[model samples]
Target chain A: MTAELPLQDASLVQWKPNRDRAKLIQMIVKVISGGFAAVSILTTIGIIGTLIIETAAFFSEVPIWNFLTDAKWTPLFSTQQFGIFVLISATVMIAFLSILVALPLGLLSAICLSEYASPKIRQILKPILEVLAGVPTVVYGFFALLTVTPVLQFIIEQLQIILPFIPDLKIFNALSAALVMGIMITPMVASLSEDAIYAVPQRLRDGAYALGATKRETVTAVVLPASLSGIVASIILAISRAVGETMIVSLAAGANPVLGFNPFNSVMTMTAFIANTVKGEAPHGTTAYFTLYAVGTTLFLMTLALNIFSFWFVRRFREKYD
Target chain B: MDVNEPTGGLEQSPEFVQDLEGRYRLDAIFEFATWAATAIAIGVLAWLLISVLIDGLGTLDWQFITSFPSRKAERAGILPALQGTILLMVVVATFSFPLGVGAAIYLEEFATDNWFTRVVEILIGNLAGVPSIIYGLLGLTVFLRLFSDITQGPTILSGGLTLTLLILPVVIVATRESLRAVPDSTRLAGFALGANRWQVVWSHVLPAAMPGVMTGMILALSRAIGDTATLLVTGAAAFIPFSPDGFLSRYTALPIQIYNWASRPQAEFHNLAASGIIVLMAVLLIMNTTAVVLRNKFQQRS
Candidate 1:
């Protein structure tokens, strides 16, 4: 084409290749990528859609109020009861117990990593601490059932001798579940909190030290406050994890879906209920089967709400720091 | 800088009724407690593995790994369940890896910082936090019902789809990190050579990011392999005799199979569960090592 055209100026007689093939490839790539994005969004929509439909079926069969407030949860027996409060109560109790045990230990571990330990020590210990996360929950369940429970029983037996004045001083109940849940979530809380604490400006620590404050005082007074939001978020995330945990409670916390406040007595959690039902010989579409959906919906909502709250917290905290 | 001089009170008291001996010494107490905490944390790993091995090692053998499950725990082998698990993983990886990586690449390379994209990012992050059980319910309703026409009942395909959703966010995030690591100048240089955006990305970005993508997929797959709750809800049967012939076949993963056997009252079943756990642990260890090695190898090159 250049040769056929008359050259008005010799300097303008240059040739470049057409990019039709490259442009076509670009269009294909764009479509493919756009398709992938669609799939991701669609999948999430599918999840939310499914949960609502099944949960709606569950609510229609068992009234929302009954599911919320009913004390007994015996969907498997002849005398069927559909109260979910027992499950929620147990879940909350175990979660609370776990937080009680985990929060202090997790916080202390964070402090050690961020404030006390040298960088060399921090690098070595962090991954080791995280190894706890790699251990399967079922294994933890076995430990809690076979080992932790017996140890707790021994302690309770001893405590019963001296604390005879205190009724229900035995340990193989809510307390044990909480203790193990805390252990399960400790890695998450500690690692996240450590990151938050470490994110606090070094200048803040320096200023506190410059004022003749001890390292301990500086950490507690300055760094802790500075990283308070992140620390709270970490704790909330840990709580969420504990609440959603299954195997630990299923194995160690026992399967009686009793609504009670006593830590020493056996109780059931929402997760434990679902696991129990799934293990049972219940036919699909039965009222019993629907119970699992309702439990799942509740558990999903609880975790989602917590996660959303934490996300907001982290965002706000980042804005302030940045 | 002014500093305080050392106090003489401790010297005067000598070794008799020292502050460290008689009273609560904060430093010593904290140090001791920290060490105790560290010990407990490490002790968990050791305790779990040791106990599981002690109980499960005797029951675990080549026959046990390859045999079909029976009413009697000792007679049962894990052949069907093992096959099902392998099939499920392959399907999950096949579907999830490409789409997840593509979405990640789009977000990193193409998407602008706008409200819609931001929302997508936020949704993905939130999805990552959702419990595995919720994914199970979704599978029960969506895949099991919507795809019932395809499978007719609960099937391995449903379980794979459910696991895919569970791990999608993870793979996307990992893929995005890898894509981001590619130098911008590399893309620019390709573009300067009159190559279109696709050519630049395909020939330069993806190749450079392959190791990272592979590492992330391995990590995500390892997580899926260990997951039992979602598969359990998605209708993994307790007994799968033969390997899965197709997506519609009823499936059983090692974890669930082990759980079924473990929950039984028989002592032999308990040993079998331990054996199952060991196999699961071995798979996990291999996956973790691969991730480490790939990450390091690519990191050195970059």
Candidate 2:
């Protein structure tokens, strides 16, 4: 309201003719943006809604008992088996195998990055790890099929001579897919756990050192314990990633719907099953079409559980270092 | 921590010396283990890059990049897939960038911290984590049912819309982060000077946050380019012999084409898949480098 005001448009008078118009603009912008934010919420609802509708159609024909109980998954055959457990077991087998490979390596690297490396070293190293995650799942799938499997088979061949009890490994087997998946997911685990580990209070480490504990002892006993929730969340996130992994397993795991846990055998995961179903032109409303949604619903629930729990841990139990 | 360490070395008792030896050994082993893990990860990356380049290098001719699919693997090329990929990126960017940025701006600047804000935050977080394949299903069911007349069923528009939905959370989250980085004092200063919320955000905050938002958008589009599963479910054809003529025309992307080619039993197709991969990675590298440079420039400025 004064001539000395710093703003360019300022005047001695408070009369700006379009000020009311600006107020109207503000309301429109806010309301319109509120609608835009709702789109994401709508997307989640659409996913669940579509899956539930189609899954219901699927259940009407096959009966829920058959889906929940049957042990075979040959939907294309005249016999028509729809065993979801077979798909789940294979999915779990790969997820378990990948987690086994990823968890220790990822956690250790995270510890190293946070505890041992300087800022300069971490700057160089963290980007290199991110590059691994940046590579597409499609490329990783190609790598598994082309490079990892042959390498795995060669190793198994060598190992077979020393340990004859090792079964004959198929070219397209769970081991190769799991190995590549673990590599693919390592960055996810490491970056996330690094945040958790880095958040641990420095005073805690100083206290451990004061007690004459070694660096190893301090990291394991003090930092890891303090950041346990975050570490577990990272693992859960990695597991979800592995479970939702489609291309790697689809390309390398050889889509045989088997129920056993042999890593050397060819098996189909739930994601692979959904993808394989879509490769063909299944007519709408057919058993084949409905199968995609049912399988998708199952996969959705699995990843949703993992994500929900991980998010809960991160929000609820993260150690704040002030 | 070392700065905070005690001034003198530990007392020179025999027990202390013994403990020091044990601690030193353990420290060496821990260091070795962590280094070895990093080494293994780096080694795998090196091997993957080398192998893809080696397999693809011989086939990287102008003819291979610009021709259509052929029965003979030697004659087949990635023209349609590449074109489709570019077209889809354009479509997805056009749809998602504005929508995502708007959402982010609204959430960060306009919404008061309340239950609605909290729900929106949690919902977006969950969306960010959903698998790509599920989005494919959503596209198939929702777009096919509602927007087929507009999107032209199973075409590039449909596939592009699928990716748009899939990457929305990624963009929103990125924009929100960059928007958050624009210090609140700037917004307060604008408000104190009588600018409205929209004018303050538009003229001040977004301009400052442009580089970050642009980087996020480009990276998200690059990610959409390599997606195979969602588009496959959205009915991106495995073999679109012709380049996409429009958003409604038949289309296939580099990743889907590579998946198709690689899955074939023939050895030659596998090599073509590798070459396609090299092209895809090159596209991504260019985009990624641009983002990195933009971010570096922004970093230098601030």
Candidate 3:
């Protein structure tokens, strides 16, 4: 059984979608990309908008000068002096303490991981550190509250006998939160610093070794210095993370915003204040609701500046291996 | 200047004598410190896991998993919280996956070496560094407050949207890296085969980049799961007795519920919080492991 074939028309061109289809796709891609970029920019703009609107409302109700200079930070109970310095102080205090702990531990861990530890060991340990990072900050909050606070209380009590200057530190204060936050951000700094250190070429290490330098000398003089920018950036990023941590400080550090720098005392951070007051279901146009936005704006600017600065520094100082 | 050197040259000195008394004491100390650091790192992980495991092991049961929270704390279950968390992840993934992939594709395939695109890239990178709490603020103000009357602010939708923002940068970075790893020749081949630009991207490029995208999605979802602050601010109700009814329904995630329970004065509540931690950890591990395995399989296949 033979099938009959139809004759082709010689005059007509074969039907094909115009090459403009590519251009059409390109246009679609362009729109999509523009949309993605716009979404990001919009988020940043949204932050600014919220901050300005809320802060303006707050300033109108309670003078901006008072919010800046007043020492007190009680909005829930009274309309008097709603200064945010206390909150800023608390945030700074905790951040400073966190950086204190994180800088040493994180830098040292990075050093050990990059310069000292075997690759096999790093393979096993890096993931463990990441897992630590992966543990919910809420879990860290509990750890701070349930475990570390009691331990601190016990230590402070024990130390009081030997040292009269211990100030009778409370367990749930800036110190504990800082310590926990430090622990939380250490893995991040360490991992990134290790990457930076490793990026320093092998020739630098070999050069140091060839000059009769010990392994420690090679790391300290050659690798560490070479990776300094990265290490700094890593530390800065860690500090930013530490500053921005919420649940840990909010849960562990007591919610009393004070303008003092005593690590022993309970102090509320900017994040904690935002978290607490925002939860109270404030009247929409009220000063309290606007204060959340103001605080958020402050936090946003602080973090944004840190990130931009760190990225710039890292990029500028990054060693060109090739 | 030569502390390790003996009265004669250190090379001529007895190896045992040098070993016993050496400046490498600092080296030993350094090694010991490194080991200590490793031990401490491991110890913290163990401490966290054990704290949760010891407290929650017996209480974690089918009933606990399936039941709703009761006014009577003892009779309460995490069913509502668990369900909310799962639903929130679904919603977050729904938004994040496409947005992340699209951003990644544009940066990798379509973007040229231009100032505007560079600025966009920088902005995305900067956004990634913004704190999750800040994202919470953004979410609360934009998604919740702006649409509160419309969507009744603090719904699962708002929370999910906030989390999508939190994870978007991470997903973009991962997806872009994966897409960049794909060879340029494949796109050329597709184009040569009479494929349109979209066809080349959607058909050839994306399939090659799928594993990476999936891996990034897993990571982004994992991050979303662990995040509580943004969700909390976005209006995850402190106590939800039942799973959310819809997108606009109030929600409570495991982390938030855990944070709530842990903050309470009751010891039983603390135990429940620990149990929640165990559940959270398990979920995170599963998600990450799956991503890693999938990535490995894809790498092998490719």
Candidate 4:
């Protein structure tokens, strides 16, 4: 028994070292993963730092006031003007127009999918709708340029005969770009809004029904109100996407930067300007090169504001049914 | 009032009956309107697909897939662009999968509740909302300028790195969701057997979460494959007559080539663009289908 006890003690001593090694390995794994996690934070810093550095360089050469207030945006021409409003106005116009097309359609689709569609129908239809979202924006740009633009031109031509006041649609018009962009974002809006609507407790709907409310009345008066924050957040996010959308506007919306709100006119958006500028060579340290960062900074700030607002709105207004 | 009557005296009033009928009719109309909205959305998708097919299907031949860009639209092929896209996907997958999964594992399995973890969570959410194009600018300054020696200038490596950053947030979010779905009981069981944290995660939790992680990875890669603006900003060449041979080789992707072709005024170029769309969509469809299948299979398992 004494000899057996010595052997057991020896085995226990051996196991202790192996366990300690395992503990060390686990600690190393955690540290490595924490390093990987830090990469995301580093990436955020890189984006902001890069934008700020280049933007500061650009602002040094071009006054901040001129960059903000100038009406002309001919950075490529010999006579360069840096009034950013030209691009901003066009960006806002297209974004607003796209939302006009997307919101009602998206909201209605959400209402139908959540309130009316059966589980089976939802299983089929939801993926089909998401397919729209999955299609690349470049493809949407192609469709806008070739299919939607021509269709709009024909419609405008026909309208001209009756309305007489209707202007001829340009080959590269904001209307085609906005319409296509809207279509591209519809699935996003629908999916998010549907999730929000679906999150509304069934008991709420039952309560509305008990009060003699019709299905339409229940959706509008109860479900939509309950999910209002989510719906609005979705819309704001969609708007942010539209503002930053590049390919659709660059290819279909044209490169002419004009400070106006005419969807019929060919207008260059801030994103389009950035895309077009980068496509051509702009030497390093040149103002033209820096404009990319300048415009990019503006874009980042705008989208960031919208994103932060949406996040805040969600946290503020979320209904805790439990 | 008769006890057996379907409607009582109050309900049988003409105005009351009329109002009920009106309400029902409005409900039906509203339902139809919602259906109409959905149909319009679907109709646009169908139209986009059909139109591209009609224009591109004729142009989509073996010769078209094998050839390089040419002055004549009919002679142009997508071989280089296709190769670049595939290689880019490989590079992106190689980097983003490990990094994103590690971050997610750290957040879900290892990290204690702290300010640093909270800050990382918020940053990732914000990063996801940041536009894809902004990542391009980051790549331009960071990869193209700062790390130009390592990346070479405007090479497939740089573009791939940029895309990896762009999709990392998506991968982390997806992975975290999957990891969260894993029950704590599984971890407890592993611990009960004297397994360490790394062993538990590597041997038990990861395998359990693999289906979802795979689905997420495929989706993220698919998004990278379709991306154009980021690559454009990262300097994917407009005309790469030769296929990329290495990471340092200048490259053009399918979407970038499609954009270049679509922007050309000639009708033939538009046809080429449509064909490229077909190829791109086909890839996406395959990826999305795989994701769905993986998710469904695993769902059935657990």
lDDT of 3 by residue, A1-322 (tens): 8664333444333655677877887788878866775677677677667778777877788877887888898877665667888888888888888888777777778778777788998888888888888888998898888888888888988998898678866756888888888888888888988889888989999998897767776777788889999999988888788778899998899788888999889889999988778667676777677788777777877887888889899889877878
Which of candidates 1 and 3 is the stronger one according to TM-score? 3
* Residues A97-176, model 2: lDDT tens digits: 99988998899899889988899999999989988889989889989999888888888889999999999879789999
TM-score of chain A of each: 0.89, 0.94, 0.90, 0.95
The candidate with the higher TM-score, 2 or 4, is 4
DockQ of 2: 0.72
Candidates 1 and 2 compared: the better one by TM-score is 2
lDDT of 2 by residue, B1-302 (tens): 57766655555434555567877888899989998888888899999999898888888799999999889988899999999999999999999988999999999999999888888898898988889999999999878657888987898888999999999999999899899889889899999988988999999999999999998998888889888899989998888788789888989999999999989988888889999999999999999999999999878765
Ranking by lDDT: 4, 2, 3, 1
Compose the digit string of candidate 4's lDDT tens values, residues B130-225. Answer: 888999999999999999999999999999999999999999999998888888899999999899888999999999999999999999999999
DockQ of each: 0.41, 0.72, 0.54, 0.83
Q: Which candidate is the best by lDDT?
A: 4
Model 4 score (lDDT): 0.93
In model 2, state the lDDT of residue B137.
Answer: 94
Candidate 2 local lDDT, residue B83: 97
Flag regions of model 4 displaced more than 4 Å: A1-17, B1-18
Clashing pairs in 2: none
Model 4 residue B173 CA deviation in Å: 0.7
lDDT (Cα, tens digit) per residue for candidate 1, span B1-302: 33465556555656744443323356456655655666676676677779888988898899998888888777878888778888899889999998899889888887889875787788788888887877887877778777788756678888898899999999999999999999999999998877777788888999999999999999899888878778877788887777778877888888788777766667788788888888888878888888889999999999
lDDT of 2 at B258: 90
Task: Rank the models by DockQ, top first.
Answer: 4, 2, 3, 1
Stretches of model 3 off by over 4 angstroms after superposition = A1-18, A169-171, B1-22
Backbone clashes for every candidate come to: 2, 0, 0, 1
TM-score of chain A of 1: 0.89
Per-residue lDDT for A1-322 in model 1, tens only? 3464555556656645668866877778877887787676776787777767778988888888877677688878888787877888899989998898788778888888777788898888887776677666776776676667778788767888988755553323667767877888888888898888998989889999797566666777898888888899999999998888887787778787788777777788888878777766457688887778878888888998999899888787752645
Ranking by TM-score: 4, 2, 3, 1
